[model samples]
Target: MGDSIIGGPRIYSCYKCRNHVALHDDIVSKAFQHVCSGKKEDRQMMTGLHMVADVHCADCREVLGWKYEKAYEESQKYKEGKFVLEKYKIVKENW
Candidate 1:
């Protein structure tokens, strides 16, 4: 057999780490396991808001900033395995 298809709207890659995360996946639920019961900083950072703000790279573990609505638009300009421009999107504007 081949790989099974995971149902979701679409997967997105982290700009810093290139880690792929499905939009429909339970990212908040997963991050909670690490964010909670960890350090005070992490717990304070998590706030446990579910979708409003929650995203981290599973690879490099870099905390992705808010504004996921524009991830796809930004990623479209670059190919996979490409480096994310450091200066781009500093203002954290939406797509």
Candidate 2:
């Protein structure tokens, strides 16, 4: 596995409810326990594909981002097993 350091440890909080959901470095491209809702196909502006679902803050129920339920591309299969964090929907707190 190739892991790139985006940054140091940071707390990711929901933009709407300010509820902490995940850590910066811990996020992947797949579903995480307690961090994502059930799979739903939706058209994403970023990916321009219909294979994502909303991730939410378990406590506040704020929409964070989408996880790949079905990968649009074969190379994106790795993303099928992780959760993609939306930069606009979350706030990062450095510790």
Candidate 3:
């Protein structure tokens, strides 16, 4: 038999926006957390944690725009440097 190997997928969660996005865990924690949000909730009888996304205000649970881990990173980068926002990837968009 060939070399049989098994590996788990990397999960990411945003800290501020509470949005969940799946990406390689090899990334930095600060970058990961800044880019990912939401809690890792189980959807049905799953073995791994399913990173989900949620849109709401930080102070209040007010319905806001679409939130994702990628945006988290974009926001941080934008704030740090006076750059444009079109470069970042907008995964999800809320009405």
Please, what are the lDDT tens digits per residue for candidate 2 over residues 1-95? Answer: 22344555567788887777776556652324446575687566455454777887887777777666677766656666467777899887764
Better of 1 and 2 by TM-score: 2
What is candidate 2's CA lDDT for residue 90? 82
Q: Could you give the C-alpha RMSD of every candidate to the true structure, in order shown?
A: 14.3, 4.9, 16.9
lDDT by residue (1-95, candidate 1, tens digit) is 11234443333455654455333233333321211111212222132322123334456655544322122234332321222212331222121
Cα lDDT over the full model 1:
0.31
Clash list (residue pairs), candidate 2: 28-83, 29-82, 29-83, 30-81, 30-82, 30-83
Q: What number of backbone clashes does candidate 2 have, counting pairs of residues 3 or more apart or in separate chains?
A: 6
Native-structure RMSD, model 2: 4.9
Local distance difference test scores for all models: 0.31, 0.66, 0.31
Model 3 bad stretches (over 4 Å): 1-37, 40-52, 70-95
Residue 34 lDDT (model 1): 19
Could you tell me which residue pairs clash in candidate 1?
Answer: none
Judged by TM-score, which candidate is best?
2
User: Total clashes, candidate 3?
Assistant: 8
Off by over 4 Å in 2: 1-9, 28-34, 42-50
How would you encode candidate 3's per-residue C-alpha lDDT over 1-95 as one tens digit per residue?
Answer: 11122433443333345454333442322233223224433232122222234433334343332232222233243222111111132232221
Instruction: Report how far residue 77 has shifted in candidate 2, in Å.
Output: 1.3
